[model samples]
Target: MSIRKRLSPEESRTAALEAARALLIETGPQSVTLKAVAGRIGRTHANLLHHFGSASGLQKALAKDLASSICAKIADAVIASRSGIGTPRDVVDLTFDAFDKEGAGALASWMLLSGNEDALDPIVDAIHDLVVELNEFGSEHLRDSTLALTLMALGDALLGGPLSASLELPRTAARDRAEAMLLGSIDQAGTLAPEG
Candidate 1:
């Protein structure tokens, strides 16, 4: 039998969350269970329970982890776009991918349907904090743009493929629309600025 390397509490928790995230992306949120995570990490269910208390708690921690990392990346993309090193499409793609490929949308819906509504607090709080942080970048319409972008991303994650196919549009139609919205917001912000 192979010996499992010891990990600190923080390291064990992080490893569990990372494994859960991978499982979420690979299978779906429904597979992100304490037993599965523990198995993946070579730990016991009791260990996961020690860290997270329950499956709901584990899911909440995973939500918080995803939100924090996604927001940081998006914030970097937004700042890079402002500095001409990135584009609005980068920000839009990141947002959409977080909801879609990263499985936040599916996980959020699962948590809600499972009646663990409070688990969404981390996601909501992260978005709010991200918006507040982005405001420092000085787009007057940042709040409205963030609101629109988030809803659009979430909706697209849920239905963009089938809906686009039904409408005879490309799968990326929603992403294109989101990019356009960001570009329009940037133009509008520029136009409304007072002359220096």
Candidate 2:
């Protein structure tokens, strides 16, 4: 029989995360499993356990990975947008794009359906970081507006069809409407709707 190769602890953990991320991107978060990720990377379920403790651990790790990457992209976009190199909306667009194109939407939907409270922690932290970064860049004025747009974008990424139906807009145009709504609110002086 042929022998399998071995990996260091760091390499194994990284491989597990990569496998989980690929499974998430390809088949959505519902399909991710420690066994599946371990199998995908030619490792064992025990290896996953050693690295991640359990499936919940793996899911939390995966969620953190996705959220961190999305936040990093947002951070990069902010850096790129300095000196009016990009519009303020670019950050919103990038955030939405990350949620849509980078599997954050699927992760969010999965976490919500699974009632995974731990998963949301990373996303909330990332958003907080983004808000701080925006404020630091002199866009403190955009805080409320930015948070609203981010909610819309993230909500749309998962529920665009329903939102479109509710608004009588095409599925593809929900984002455009969201952007317009944000722009309209940009000139308004207020806090976030005074949460009830």
Residues 36-69, model 2: lDDT tens digits: 9988998888878988887878888887887788
Q: After superposition, how far is residue 13 of candidate 1 from its true place, in Å?
A: 0.2
Candidate 1 residue-wise lDDT, 109-140, digit = tens: 99999999797899989989988887864655
Candidates in order have lDDT scores of 0.94, 0.75
Where is model 2 more than 4 Å wrong at Cα? 137-140, 165-168, 181-196
Poorest stretch of ten by lDDT in candidate 2: 186-195
- Measured with C-alpha atoms, the lDDT of residue 148 in candidate 2 is 73
